[model samples]
Target chain A: MDIEVIKRYLPLFSKAFLLTVKIGWLGIALAFVLGILCAFTLYYKLPVLSTIVRFYVELFRNTPLLVQLFFIYYGLPSIGIRISAQLCGTLGLGLLGGSYMAESIRSGLEAVPAIQSESAKSLGMTKWQAFRYIIAPQAFNISVPGLMANVIFLLKETSVFSAISLMDLMFTAKDLIGLHYNTTESLFLLVLFYVLMLLPVSFAGSLIEKKVRFGMYGD
Target chain B: MEEILKVEHLHKSFENLTVLEDVSLTVNKGEVVVIVGPSGCGKSTFLRCINGLEDIQDGRVILDGQTINPPLQKGDNYRQRIGMVFQSYELFPHKTILGNIMLAPIKVQKRDKNEVRAEAEQLLEKVGLSSKKDNYPRQLSGGQKQRVAIVRALIMHPEILLFDEVTAALDPEMVREVLDVILELAKQQRTMLIVTHEMAFARAIADRIVFMDGGSIIEVSEPERFFTEPRTERAKRFLKTFEY
Candidate 1:
């Protein structure tokens, strides 16, 4: 209700929003790389590494990101393995998001019929060429909707970065509310900043989903 | 006659269940060999083994006097010399008809794009599918997709082509269109190993008929003799079923 309070805290919130976006995107990028690697490992059923990847996926996916963050930030240092809070936040988000992404990508890869790869091989394509040219593109199209969901999910997950002492959007709002008792204004700005971060991703995701559904990748 | 493919002492089994047992056959250059039998006689498995798609328990598939069954690390290069079309057409649903046709030629064979494109167009025209070139696989009928699959294989210019019941998935009406394409290839003396249940078409197109039963070749004879005076009781029984 207090416009003055909101206006006064706008600069701080803006800076925090930028921090949230930067850390969130970096974590998401890391998640994508990890997810693709893990998914391929499982898809190809690579011997020992697949078992480790399966265990990793289950461990991260089944647990809450908050606990993982706590373990990375608080517990690890107790063992003399120190990492900065910012890095801790990004790492935790990425590790958690990677599990979800791996599942999504693995499902996408599985959804492609076996005959596609067989036909590719029948054409004298190396396994790598089949994957790169035939399997990867189709799997990517199938994965878009799921991956977009993961992107938004990972972005929203950045709110918990404040728990690790990173000055993200949520931290700014909670700090302002605690100091000035402007609960309504701080909460309102928190909602607004989160939407600003997530809406474009949602829009872009749907756009991509539409293109994939319509087979835009085809010649 | 010069032999282009030779399958010697092929033994294929799936974990103790025999699928193909000690089956061997030779395909000469410009020969059309059609294998016909009751379902589950290992006809498709034999074709798959020849293309190195399935591992064999005991066998050596020689292509141009080189063993290719336990294919080398550059198996793609060996596989490139043998093209295969599947029963389900298996055209890449994400690619255009033309894209599906030109992909291996450009990517695997590393041929020029424009040249492959031109050959693909000619093949498409030959198959009566030139108009559907830019369309996706899902946009076409089963027969159209099969035609594209054939074109995909033919563009590779493999020494031998394997067709694993390519028309088996088509509607009855669509079957003839696909069969016509294969028959045309036969007229051109393309070396092909086809597995099909279409007895009349098999009789019409096959230079030699290979009759298999329970994973073993019971008969390999000329089409006229195989269809008219089948050598074995199993072949007699199989041909009897087709009698209307």
Candidate 2:
């Protein structure tokens, strides 16, 4: 392992790391929002929308993210619509992560007893008020820790974006290995960069979990 | 006192199973009615039907001269007028005791925060839980949770209060605290339909005691006569269970 090759690759790797972060941020945020909306639609039992959401969740959950990414990035142009690779990659991540996230949030919604709504209603709250004030907050609290942990996997999943030439961290590492004829340093740095990125997120999730967990079941 | 609530020829079912069959009762304003029956005999369902939490297949629930059922009444009226407490306490766990008490008043009633908070604090004091105002439901004991649930109901200033075995979830020692709160509220002449198996508490607070079996009211009599001289065979059989 030549220290000099690693030194030379550091600038490129750092730039790729930033790209990975940017994609992860956009994809995870979109997924979280989309997932929550799907969960709410299922929970509130919207008529046609609920059916559509269920079908969407099933379709995404059952398929491979890579296949979905390829179709978006590679398949769309053949049909006359052209989009950027990053946009396609981000959309693929959002669509894929959203299905699992919907399941997680649905479980969170179920964890709240039906009686909460009944009690809220009995107190003269409107159904919308009950949902907004009582049910949604508790459900979010129940979902936050698990969903935050999911973000780590989401970040790791960004590696798939490199397949579409998105210039993410994995692509940078692979490019360097090809150019410098060095595998050990590239792989080691790749693992180290992910660790550096994920450890703080994991720590923050655990911290939030503890804060919400306090006075949750017992003081 | 005028009639505040009346259940007429009510029947409720879940899919193929009928839980309440041809049940009817009347509650006058400022009346305390105690309903007791074996488990699964539809005691709680009766309370829920009054609050419109459960749908009825037949008949109506009249509240303040207005029909409070779906076909005639808006969902808002039943909710605003009828307050209910569950066997499980059903206090919002994520909210503080004060937040649990204040939510409906502020959000639904659109009341001023300072005024509502002051009123909530007074209710907490009334329940002897003023110190627990800032506490979450999980921070309190079973008795305290029940007390907070009571305050939550009372804060709504409901026309009628329905309690579904509020003490059933508590320890034996905790039951009295909740019953005391109910009895205190009873003294203030709040209309209440309480479903409880605590016959002693029922006899103390109830103006009328309803005995139900097989989803039907077997007897409805004043507390003293019903306990001492039950008229129906079912009531006699029911009372006989506690004799030992």
| TM-score, every prediction | 0.96, 0.93
lDDT of 1 by residue, B105-175 (tens): 88887899999999999989998888999888888999988988888989988899999998888899999
Residue B110, candidate 2: Cα error in Å is 1.2
Go through the candidates in order and give each one's C-alpha lDDT.
0.91, 0.87
DockQ of all models, two decimals each = 0.62, 0.68
Cα interface RMSD of each candidate: 2.2, 1.8
Query: In angstroms, how far off is B179's CA in candidate 1?
Result: 0.7
- In terms of TM-score, which candidate is strongest? 1
Report the Cα lDDT for residue B5, model 2: 92
- Highest DockQ model number: 2
**Residues forming the 10-long window of minimal summed lDDT in candidate 1 chain A:** A210-219
Fnat of each candidate: 0.75, 0.79
lDDT (10s digit) by residue, model 2, range A1-219: 778877877887888888888888798988999999999899879999999999999999898888899888889999998999888878988998898799889889988888898888888777888888888878878888779867887888988888999888899889878887689889878887888778988898888877876656542
Model 2 residue B30 distance off true place after TM-score fit, in angstroms: 1.5
RMSD of each: 1.9, 2.2
Model 1's chain A TM-score stands at 0.95
lDDT of 1 by residue, A1-219 (tens): 989988998999999999999999999989999999999999989999999999999999999999999999999999999999889988998999999999999999998988889889889888889888888888989888889989999999898999988999999999988898999999999999999999988988888788766653433
